[model samples]
Target: MKLQTQVPLNKATNQIDYSSQLVVLGSCFANNIGDKLAYYKFRALQNPFGILFHPLAIENLISRAIQQKQYTEEEVFFLNERWQCYDAHSDLSSVRKEELLGSLNSGLLETKLWIAKASHVFITLGTAWTYQLKESGKEVANCHKVPQMVFKKQLLSIDRIVQGLKDMLHLIQAVNTKVKIVLTVSPVRHLKDGFVENQQSKAHLISAVHQIIKTGNATYFPSYELMMDELRDYRFYGNDLVHPNDLAVNYIWEKFKTVWISETSYKTMDEVAAIQKGLDHRPFSQESEKHKEFLKTLGNKITNLQKEYPFMKF
Candidate 1:
């Protein structure tokens, strides 16, 4: 008897190969999958503005990037001796306003270029819940430790989420028509919103994603279903009990590979994995002949791989 239910994922019509340039956005889970892509040395740009959990934040960023709109002083504010942009994650915040502006503009330009050429775009929506700045009456991607009283907490309606996703796809397709968009509700639970509320938030996100898929604009990856049904045990959870642990992430990634990644790339992925492992190996005797030999072998392996994949970097 089968102990667990499996998500039936059909092979994608358009598979990801070395030639494919990937752009990943939205949520911490997006980073998790993007990290796997990076590990295999795939050409991927992930979350340039950092983890955006909700659809509106993602929509806002995409609009700004495609429009080539530059961020100004009004969009950024000085807080706790540091400058912060409500549109960006705290990861992009800096002590110097000029540095922050430079980073944001550069990232926006890079993201615009990435979207223009991306073969596949993966979006992982984390929650339906969002916070809007009360003063500006605008939704904030991240509060950046701003006082709670300054924002109005709310859950996005299903209609709004669907509309935001449609806008995101329209903006992307305007720049690149051939891009295949994949949408997934992040398996990571936002329990801080309260357990029941978290479930409601996830339900809303899942519903919105399906609506997008039904319209033939995107495909759905059953990441949330896989986590909930296949890896139902607590062992799949991280120490925080909200995020998936490394093993769980790997499991989901393996499933992703079977469906999305091209089978022809497996051999190259093996070579890349071997090189990664060799590079990560710690030598006890750096001056020893064996260590030197190992280094030479590793160098040769990298050289061979780079010859085949000139874009690959060690």
Candidate 2:
């Protein structure tokens, strides 16, 4: 039987059945999760705008929620020239999947709007350890331009992680209370963080996220434990004994597939009607609140638009 649980922050759990208008962010695991959903012919969409490797995108997406513009792949542009998850280091690779998205929108504003329209947002927190720039003292994701040695190996404080999660929840609620969030802690060990320290880092992330997840809301997924328990065996790991091989990603993805694409939780007619009716089209999205009203107005005008602009039906 599929494992199911209900807690405070995460109220219910079991295999998620049916199709969902979902978006994924955080951690490299999201890439795998997105791929599996598509493989199963679900309504899941990878980052509409593009690659988002940082939390700032969370804030940006919420800021644009109230504006009445449709969140499409064309609107969002990436911060860097290119968007990616792993450096050739990851086990799974999908050239076709990588090309499907364009980039993030302008700042947090548009990103929030897209998220508001999404039915589900699944987040995977990859690591507790991050490199903070000495100059800005800010934690950097990717560290592409930032020198590795200039940064010191340190764990993000649990307090910060909790606060970030709380803020994100509020942001998500503001856009669409119906939009549920599933949080997960990635189990891939950090080979560079020392053997013992890597375990400590994983423990830190899992414990902090679990503190909220165990409450029984729809806010978390047991990705960390799933990996540690099911794929932690020596045979499952790669030669480095750090990262899991393609088989591991594939296995975890199958489990994620069962949860996000459940048969019963499929999108309802109302949601489809809204999208089909072109409620997401925002020809004039200036401010965040403006976009919010636009969607509402579009809902009101959906049928009228069909009658008036028959050619615009898309």
Candidate 3:
């Protein structure tokens, strides 16, 4: 089936001026847009705990918003309250507790909350391919410890993706009928998927996103197009091309700011880029021969952790 290519917001026959409370969901791409909206001074909420992975997380978050969806009356809990194990020597126990009993879902839930509050919701659909569990058949968190044999790779179809957006639209409208929707695909390549599979997979996502925008009124930002087209030159990519380098994110962000937000938003994303510069920049941290020993220790810890949580899903 044919789909209309989404023009840059500036080129659209009907331009939109939207400033509303925001939430970001879906994939890592939302991280950039969410940061921009916050920089633009829109009331924006990033996923409180961290990025979540599925519909249950989103549903649980909204349920919490409407009521106290906590496991018990205390309301002081972690990601999983059912587990009574505690660690006396761990400083991360508190964080682990919160994650166990808390309401943090996928990053997309952040987008959902933003949709409920904002006049317009911008969604960034990442890869169509998802790693889901075999036993429960649910999508696991990050595919951490999932047995490769037990886990399966799946790609959502155009119809299903469209239906999900429509459903989300209806759900958000139920809470606030005035919310508008903007959709875009993520441009980062998945080295995991062979090149051909990756392109066809992304095309499937772009098709659905494009088809939904064809009805008019709603907007579709060309984040994916800008990245794939304008930023795909070999020089734009990093050593490992799976994730966009900071330069690439900035290039795409500049194009996106002109189309969606403002020059100020562009600057804010730039700040993020600046901060990322020193993430792996520590003097003598890795240069010393100590790194080899450190890696061995780290590997052993990983091995032990895996043994303890073999069924753990990332």
Candidate 4:
């Protein structure tokens, strides 16, 4: 008998191989998958702007990037002695104003170029709730620790979410008509929104995503279902019981590889994984002959792989 009810996933028609260029953007779960691709030495650019939680925020960023819009000085403000842009994550906030501006502008250009050439763009939606700045009536990606009074919290309707995703798809296809989009809802629970509210938020996201998927402009991955169903135990969760632990992430990633990644690239991926594991190995006897031999072997492996794929970096 089957121990777990597995989500039935078909192999993607547009499979990702080592040659494919990828751009992953959206929630923190995007980071998890992006890092895995990076670890496997795939050419991937992930969340250049930062970790955006909601679909509208993600759409806003993608729209701006496609338009090559520059972030002006007026768009950012000094808060707690640091310069912050409401459109970006707190990690992009900087102590120096010029540094923040340069970074934002550079990131926009990079992201625009990446999307235009990317074979696959993975977008993970985290929630349907968003915060709008009351003064400008603009939806902000991150509040940046601003006082709660300055922002109005709102739950986006399914219609609005669907429209935003469609807009994002249009914007992307306008630049790169053939790009394949893989959309997934993040499994990380936002219990801070209250359990019931969190469920409502996820429901809105799930509904909107499925609508978009039906358009054939994108494909849907059952990441949320995988976590909620197959790995339903608390052991799969982090200490907060919100985010998936490392093991859970790995499990989901393995499932993703089977469906989304090209079968022909499996051997290459294994080779890459071996090289990565070797690089990560810590030797207790750095001066020993055995350790020196291991280093030589590792160097040879890197050299051989780099010969085949010149773009790879350790």
Instruction: Kindly list the per-residue Cα lDDT of model 2 for residues 162-280, writing each as its tens digit.
Output: 66667777767776877778888766777677888777777766666776676544466677676776665777677887666678887776565455445453443233445554544
RMSD values, in order shown: 0.7, 13.4, 13.3, 0.9
- Candidate lDDT scores, in order, read 0.95, 0.56, 0.55, 0.94
- Candidate order (TM-score): 1, 4, 3, 2
TM-score-superior candidate, 1 or 3: 1
Model 4 TM-score relative to the real fold: 0.98
Candidate 4, 1-314: lDDT as tens digits: 87898788888898999899999999999999999999999999999878999998899889989898999999999999999998899889899999999999999999999999999999999999999989889999999899999999999999999999999999999999999998999999999999999999999999999999999999999999999999999999999899999999999999999999999999989999998899889989899999999999989999998999999999
How does residue 64 of candidate 2 score in lDDT?
Answer: 42
The lDDT leader among the candidates is: 1
- Per-model TM-score, in order, reads 0.99, 0.61, 0.64, 0.98
TM-score of 2: 0.61
State the weakest 10-residue window (summed lDDT) of model 2.
85-94
Tens-digit per-residue lDDT, 19-129, candidate 1:
999999999999999999999999999999999999999999899999999999888999989999989998999999999999899989999999999999999999999
Which candidate tops TM-score?
Answer: 1
Cα lDDT, model 2, residue 280: 40
lDDT of 3 by residue, 1-314 (tens): 73433334573332223334555655566776666555433456654434433333333344444343334324332333232211111121244544544333232354445556675555666676766667667554354333588778787788876776666556666777776666777777766778888897788878877777886635777777776756646676778866677787776766665665544334444433343443334656776777667666555644554464343211
